[model samples]
Target: MSLAPILLFTYNRPEHTQAVLDSLSKNKEAIDSVLYIFCDGLKENSSEENKSKNKLVQQIISSENRFKEVKITIQTKNKGLARSIIDGLNTVFLEHEKLIVLEDDLILSPFFLAYMNDSLNRYKDFKNVGEIGSCNFFACGKEFPTYFFTNMPDTWGWGTWKDRWNKFNEDAVFLYKELEKNNKMHAFNTYGAYDMEGMLKDQIFGKVDSWAIRWQAVMVLNNWLCLYPNPSYSNHIESINATHAKINMVPPLQNNEPTFETIEIKELKNVTEAMQLGYSGKGDYFGKLSKKYLKKKTKKILKSVLLFPLPYGIVAFFKKNKPKK
Candidate 1:
């Protein structure tokens, strides 16, 4: 099998970067793969502390040559994650037909490279299949198959062909307008359980800068399918200083070795049963209770901290006013 080049994007987290690289190095195929590391520069008006951290990240990447070849690119100015990824993928795809993408926080299982390369080779000619996702967040119990098809594409750890990626629409406003005109907004929201709709609104309104949402929208708009493994080949070790920390829906299940040699590609339109279990926020008690419960608990804790004596006094007053039992 011809190995796909690995493109890893990183910021100022040196420890996270090291851990990710260490795990990747453990892959048997990684020794034969080429790695491209893109280190995003510091933001404007950034503190010296952040700049130092960014340097540390660069140093960590440069210190390792775990792959067949490692190339590093350091931006002079902060291109931000969205632009860095967009530009980095664009630059590398020019030289490579297919590539695997990863961030600094995702730790890979040993079979990650095998799965990605095998899937890329298998689905290279499948026009409707857009990307192969290595991480599965669905808590579909322990009785699931080895792999399955899903409509949603995940970014935790993934791979794609240049042909499929060419369909990506970078302009959010234009994509949103197209969705609105075609009356696909409802379907889009339904496919992602309102998550895609909210992300599109935020991206267009300048409330947030996201590239993954836009990529997913482009793929969905074109009716592309994503292949997902049942037991995820990667786990996201979220960074503490991350500006946008995603809420984990379930505990990541590990699969160090998974075989897809004889797996058939089944294009599923509505795998409602499995998808419903995947999105915790859309169907169950955990989804309903997560945000509201956290908010109430935080408020009570703050009240106790700020109005310590007052809260206790009020509690005592309320108890004293109760009828004797």
Candidate 2:
């Protein structure tokens, strides 16, 4: 079997980076797989504290060689996460036919690499299989197949073949315009739980920078799909220190190791009721809603505490307009 290389992207969180590396190294295929670590540089005019963390991350990766072959790329100029990932994928895919990808905050299950490599080989020739993901955020019923297909692609811990990845368009405008021209806006949103069109629009206006949203657009435009192993094989830590981190966004689902020896791949044209529930914010709606409520409530409370020096009326004004979470 040809082992796909592993590409890990990291920024300033050294502790999270170390924890993720330790979990990855525990994977059975760790010793045989090639590891490619991309350390993004500090953004221009970044604070001293951020620069310090970035340096620490670089140092930690440099000292580790857990995989069979370790390759490190340090960007001299800050290429934000999205650009760094786009560049890394293009460069690495050029060398290897397939590769597994991870970020600093995601911790892998011991079986993650095995499942990814197995699925990669199983569906490599299937033009519809764009990528294989280790995490399944959807709370599909306990009885669903151990592995299944969906049009949604997850970026947490994933792998893809060169051909599937080559379809990605870096130009958000190009993708948005194409989708708009085709009258596929509504269809794209139904493909997954979230509003992909809105995300693409944000990307176009520079409100947010994300490579996954564009990739999702490409997958929808090309009628491609992603395969996922039920019971997530990876856990997202979502470090509080990471910039723009949305902890528990989609919240991690239960992780279960499968008993099956082989994965069966097939075409799934429609979203399963389970997939819909999971993605549509309805699968685990109550639990997810509770989490969001708590997070928002806590943030508001913290703000109130921080502004205690203000007049009682001012704080009372904030309390009065508080939206029900």
Candidate with the greatest TM-score versus the true structure: 1
Off by over 4 Å in 2: 191-193, 244-271, 285-325
- The 10-residue segment with the lowest total lDDT in model 2: 281-290
TM-scores vs. true structure, each candidate:
0.83, 0.81
Q: Candidate 1 on 126-224: residue-level lDDT in tens?
A: 887888988876523445566666667878899999988888888999999888888777656655455678789899999988888898788768777
Q: Put down candidate 2 lDDT per residue, 192-298, tens digits, no spaces.
A: 45687888899999999999889988887887778876677886886566665564544444345555344444544433555555555554522233455467779
Residue 202 accuracy (lDDT) in model 1: 94
Position 228, candidate 2: lDDT: 74
Candidate 2 residue pairs that clash: 277-283
The TM-score measured for candidate 2 stands at 0.81
